[model samples]
Target: MKTFTSGWAFQKPDQNYFKKFIRLNNIAIDGIVYPKKILADIEGIPVLGFDDAHDIIQPDDLVLDVSTNPDLRKELEPFFAAKDIDCVSVPDYLDRLLSADQHDALLLPVAGIKASDIRKLKSAPIPDRFDAHFLDAESYEVASKLDGIFRHSQWQRLVEFDRDDPTGNVLFNVLLDLHARGLLKHLSA
Candidate 1:
């Protein structure tokens, strides 16, 4: 029932046969591909998977959105009312799930450093391979913008500071490096 609508659905496509079925032989299923139509049936409920966007839907599939898609809402409401399937708005769902503690859990906290430790922290060279792999200009921009505590929105804004780099992996790796170096602490509740 919990579906991510903001392209934040944590998923990796199964690199297997039926996935290939979509790629290789769409004609076999009347041109209905995995993402183009309902990808599969999950316990009698059709599951539609989308990342950037979806232009299609079947009556039986579960779809997630942000309530911003009025056209889709109008189209999908009959199915939802009949309990034939579910249509969920992720932002609304997130509002229901998020509390102050839940909100705080998502922040990355910068560790407090003493003046004495500043030199050590600076002198401690980042490993060359790690630097080469993760520390690009984008990553540096992200890292430099981290505060004592910050949320994903702040981090996202920092990532998009200079240019529009929507690829989150580089920013993730940069944060991961800070975590590895004991400079960043992720709070959980």
Candidate 2:
């Protein structure tokens, strides 16, 4: 009965449909739609404002904080820690998940997973077209900061993050390789 409290992007309109869909599948998830920062339920797995989000997440839940502000983790970690919950900013989460020989992230599922012996959360979504939805000021800030990271990485060949990616797996994999080779800082830096 773990809840995947994803940090959703702003203005996502599928919360209602997603809540209904989860109810039909009996996944024990509540599609909490925050008016200030909408969360994505599908493969997009968008981000949301973490301040108010802690209220909705239950103990043992994992929150994906997508704010580009590096200080956000410092602020969130202690709060979630007090509540017995786990939290990770997007980049940090990916870096850890893709790390090898140094972490236990391999236990986590990549796309979908084997659930309840049969019902599966199949992996598929529209091409996301996230650039279209990233019209918010925060999105612009995140994009700008991450763009600087891409330009500054020592990956030998250019590593570009596809804003249109629905699942953000590109950034995750890149972060893993860069971190492994010691070519990048902690999280796709």
Candidate 3:
């Protein structure tokens, strides 16, 4: 499930667009309006209080930061980062989802998301290296070399022979796909 917290930063967000975005992605998100100012009457999502949000949000939950205020960013960024909560601007999220076509829902909106409340646009950051949290050193070596990304189906088709590799052939398929995309080089036999 996705989670969000709307802060004092929001001026006039497109509530209707937000609703359609959630529905199109079928994201089961719980949101809260802090300072009790944002009176967005989201139909399915419940408006939670600060205390409720603190208790409910865990690691991986995203905190929406629509503010361009440096002071607000300084104060909030560390707090959320310490708690392992991801903070993202709504615009960035929408762009990534749309561009990647990563929506999990069967039905999607034909139109694009409108960012009426956004002040300054935030650009997506390119990763310098892969985070080897769940991967071993050997796996990390290959993963770290992946300088680009492609659709899984495209990669899968490139390695079509492994579809029946009973063991799932996950790492091999991924490595092979990266190699095919020219994202991996100097691979040892």
Q: What is the TM-score of each candidate against the true structure?
A: 0.25, 0.28, 0.40
| Evaluation by TM-score, superior candidate among 1 and 2 | 2
Q: Which stretches of candidate 3 lie over 4 Å from their true place?
A: 8-15, 33-42, 66-82, 102-189
Each candidate's root-mean-square deviation in Å? Answer: 18.0, 18.3, 17.6
lDDT of 1 by residue, 83-102 (tens): 44454543333233233323
lDDT of 3 by residue, 1-189 (tens): 566755533233433344455676577656644533245544545665545666777777666665455765675566566567777766556555545553433333333322321111123233334553535554554443321212111121223232455343677788888888888887642
162 Cα displacement, candidate 3 (Å): 51
lDDT of 3 at 105: 30
**What tens digits encode model 2's per-residue C-alpha lDDT throughout 1-189?**
345543333244323323333344454434322323543453444333455555666775656543333454455556666767665544443343333314332322213311221111113222232557576765665555544432222111112332366355576777888898987765644
lDDT of 3 at 71: 67
Runs of candidate 2 exceeding 4 Å displacement? 2-55, 88-189
Query: lDDT for every model?
Result: 0.36, 0.43, 0.49
Q: What is the Cα-based TM-score of model 1?
A: 0.25
List pairs with backbone clashes in candidate 2: 7-46, 7-47, 7-48, 8-39, 8-46, 8-47, 8-48, 9-47
